[model samples]
Target chain A: MIRVNNITKTFAEREIFSNVSFSIPDAKIYALVADNGVGKTTLLRTIANIYNADSGNVVSSAKVSYLPEERGLPLEQKVFDFLLFVAQLRGMRKKIAKTRITDLLKKYSLFEFADFYIGNLSKGMQQKIQFLSVIIDNPKVLILDEPFSGIDEKNKELFWEELLELKNNGASILISAHKTDDLTHFCDAFLLFDGKSIEMVDSLQLQVEQK
Target chain B: MINSIRIIWLVAKNEMKQMFRQRLFVFLLFILTICAISDPGKENLYFMFFVLNFSMALFRSIASEKESRLAEYYISIFSPTKLLLGKIKAYAIFFFVISLLINICAVAGLLRFVDVSFLPCVSMLCGWQVFVQLLGCVFYLSLVAFGASYSRVHTEMQGSIFVIAILMVSSYFVVENLADIFGNVLLCETLLKYIPFTMPFVKGVGILPMCVSFVAIIFILKFSGKIYKKRLFYYGKNKITEG
Candidate 1:
């Protein structure tokens, strides 16, 4: 479980958020819905502890991972070389991580492109590899900021399946986006920001539970 | 320890791939080789130095991603320290190989055509060039990595580190190369051994500075990690963590 209490952040003179607070229960998929430039990325960064909040406390386990809203791949790095590196940084051995990379590359349907550099691949392919860089480690607190933004419908379906698998295994997901309908299937509840504060749609029923 | 090694290893491997495989890395190698071989006599060292600084700047651009907003994705999974090690290690290798290449070309050209036995000198000179350039590269790499880590702009890493290169080179020469006294006379040569940077040159390509260099690397390894954790400055602004 992740508990965020009274968090606030500002950029220069602009206030991004003010004492916003919420809790993400274990095994729950919380979609952070808001229009653009409302500090969606900032909030996700704060949650990932990549950005320190001006006020409030964020409590969570150490087993957390974040997928930034922007592209982070080293364009010259081959797909397999990159993800194995991420796994290593998070405490996996090189040999062990390389073995895992083989499994993940195939699973992501990237087996053919495993040796190909990211710059040579399409955006969605790179994005999927970027996602694989995080998910290969099996983070308990899975934070993805606008991961679906640039992906096509077919690729999004592939991502949805991988994410749903994580959710079923008791992962807590924090996803921020402008589109609500595309994510209605897996989101257990919704968190909305109206540019001032954050409010959770606590009573919304999950598709499975409602059925 | 193992995890950090793995990350750093991958970082070095990736950088080597970029330096060797891509059309750009190959183009750079060709340009640098032309510069190294085409120059006449000891003047080649001057061209090699230009190539040295050029390669350093190039690697800086490649290594700057770890410092920018682009770093946000990777930094979440890897600690700032591990990330720093990876980048530092990668760029160091880039500088190392290219500088070694320069040293070899210079020595071989001096020995083959001029008959100075660069092969006899390669062991001593390679040792000196590798360790010295490696040290210089890490110092620059750390500064760039820190700037990139703290900046929203990825390209800022290149600018920030490069702008300080003149100062860095000045310091490196004044402190490190000053010791040899450029192989001068007896009275001065005796005293040169006592000056830290000057004294290492008396060892004449021994492990003297190499040992000290390792200590400095460890110091950077330990200090930068603490700086990021206690001070959340990676957001392009400083925010102290208050309990």
Candidate 2:
């Protein structure tokens, strides 16, 4: 569903990573594990077309929903307003967006928090809101950076459940997480991210190309 | 594009919330009205000038979020052109409401004190002022949006370069007024021709200036859209996005 070749990103004359290349298989959970500034988010940006590749190309057949590790949620935002905005952006109508947001809120036990300002909630809760903002749309591909950081264990578990359900429902997932141990269970394969090199990581065969 | 529009509206609606969340909007209107009404005779024009400066300062606050990473979340997703348009739309509505209130106040205050003939000046003055301010907002935010998109540090301050630029561009207008004291209307006319800001305004009985403003908006919109398209590194100065 996605192919990236020799994608290089630099900031301030310093190279973040170079010659990064990979292809995400259809309907599989692809985990891109790396330390901060190792070009994980930059790589995702390239795939999402937020940042262009310096010397390579990323070809993707699926629409992508990108979730950055940062606190992307506006704290003063209302849950309904926030989710509805995201849903509508993915091309949902206002009424459909409203209905979808209501269902997601209730399903996630966020019904009571729907009207609460994001800033008034705990950081974990706010993170969930941010996640919902992206996931509510159900894009063909999900690219997440640090998807499990900063949330409560319960919320984290809920995220895993939701992710597995998404995967089962034919959505390809690519994620970067701090906890490499928990990833072995669901993530079919990963990209090894060191400071200068992003290696294709698999007990199975992996493709490599340089731009 | 629908996605872009929805996202822009969300961000803009939130921006409006932020505007109202702070008491500054109401405070500015209140202070301006009080100043206009309390003025004594022709001295009110002096107060009116102060109101202009105050409004400029108030409107500049709209760019504050872009200066900070506060707007970054949405910035990462939407096209820069749409983002700029949405923010400007919200600010336009804000300025329109404020302009309406200020116009009403100015007309009432002027009728109560200055020559009642000043009533005719209301529509013209307010129209010109609103147009000029809108021009300033567009010009300033276009650059600020660039700074936010590209600059690595202290973008808030970097965004002010646009505001300072407006000041510099309009500085020639000031010179024309001062030169008139010496009955140097010819020199003022000649100087105004070469000056960038004055040139646009007087090229054809305000038509040139209006056309220039509209053209400038299209230019900025086109440029920002190009950045959204072919440009890899936006925050045009920021290399972070350079692949």
Candidate 3:
């Protein structure tokens, strides 16, 4: 479980957000819905500890993984090697990391291209690798910012299946994406950012309101 | 403590693996090897080349990571201190090997002029040179890392690299003439030997510079680690000014 207590953030003498608080319970996915230039990415980054809040704190002992909105990948690195290093950095043993990476690649049908440099892959494939790196460790708290911006529908479906699997295993996910139709199906709740704060709304209630 | 060390090692190993494949780095190594082998009597010039080459490589590595925003990802996932240490560790190992090779080449060049019986003395001298060069390289690289962290763009870092190179050359000149200014050769030598930039050019092995270099490394890493933590997430807007 992730508990965020009245987190406030400011930058460059401007308030990005103030007094925002929410908690993500285990075994569920939450969609962060907000228009561009809003505090969606900033809020996610704060929760991931990439950016510190001006006040309050995030309390979670569970292992967390983050996928930034921008593609934060080393183009020079091969897919398998990159994922293996990330796994090891996350404190997994090398042998286990290697095996886990191999299994993931096979499952994703990327085994043949595991040795290819990430720069050589298509945009969708590269984004797929970025997502794979995040989920490789089965993080208890997964935070994603605009994770599905430029991918095709097919890959998006594949990602949703994997995210559901992770959720079933008791991981809490906070994902912000442009595609609400895709997220509305499986995401257990929606955290709507209104440029100043976040309001948590149930998925069923959100669906009824959308109707 | 053990886990921290392990994290550093893992980062270092990964960095080394990736760097080996960089075409620019391979080209730099080729040029360095040629310079080391071709220049015989100019050890000071060779040391400058060493500084320029390694510092550029280090700067390029840091700059590219920043440009690509990969540094942000690494910082988000792992502590910046461990990541920086790991990067420095890898560069230190690379610098040590290259310095050793350069010293070996210099000693080999001396083979043509020195007496055959003095080969053992030359080898011992070469060993001392390698030790001193390693220390000097680490010192300069740490400074380079510090400068690279604060630079907001590629041109800015390029300017910083040139400034650092000049500072290195100036250190050699200062250390060489300090005795004349002080009118006491022994005292000057004792004090000036602690200057890491002078370590590679010194004729004999001295312990002062080694101690000084270790302290400088620790202090600089601490200072730079703080800068890195602050600057790692800063995605500043780049704008051109009107003339």
Best by DockQ: 3
- Better model by TM-score: candidate 1 vs candidate 3: 3
In the range B43-80, model 2's lDDT, one tens digit per residue, is 22432343344334333443344432334445456666
Q: Clashing residue pairs, candidate 2? A: A54-B243, A75-A119, B149-B235, B150-B235
* DockQ of the candidate models in sequence: 0.33, 0.28, 0.46
User: TM-score of A-chain in each prediction?
Assistant: 0.92, 0.88, 0.96
Please report, in order, the local distance difference test score of every candidate based on alpha carbons: 0.67, 0.62, 0.81
Question: Residue A122 error for model 3, in Å?
Answer: 0.9
As a whole number from 0 to 100, the lDDT of residue A34 in candidate 3 is 89
> Residue B44 in model 2: shift from native, Å?
13
Rank list by TM-score: 3, 2, 1
How do the residues A81-122 of candidate 1 rate in per-residue lDDT, one tens digit apiece?
778767876777779889888998887789999989788998
Prediction 3 TM-score vs. true: 0.89
Number of the top TM-score candidate: 3
What would the per-residue lDDT of candidate 3 be over residues A1-211, giving only the tens digit for each residue?
A: 8889998988776788888888899998999888888878878888888777889999875967988887678898999999999998888888999999999999888999999999999888888898999998888999988878888888888998999999999999999965467677889999888878777888898788889
Would candidate 3 be rated incorrect, acceptable, medium or high by CAPRI criteria? acceptable
lDDT of 1 by residue, B1-243 (tens): 765677677666655565565565567656765775566343223423543454454445434464344556656666667656765676566656666776667676666665455477665765575565466456555654555444434455556655555545554454444446355455454554343333323334335555565666666666765455434334444543333
lDDT of 2 by residue, A111-180 (tens): 9988988778877677778788878866668888788876778998889888888888778889886545
lDDT of 3 by residue, B19-132 (tens): 798788778777877876787656666777766777887788888888888887787788766776788788778877876777787777787988889889888877887777
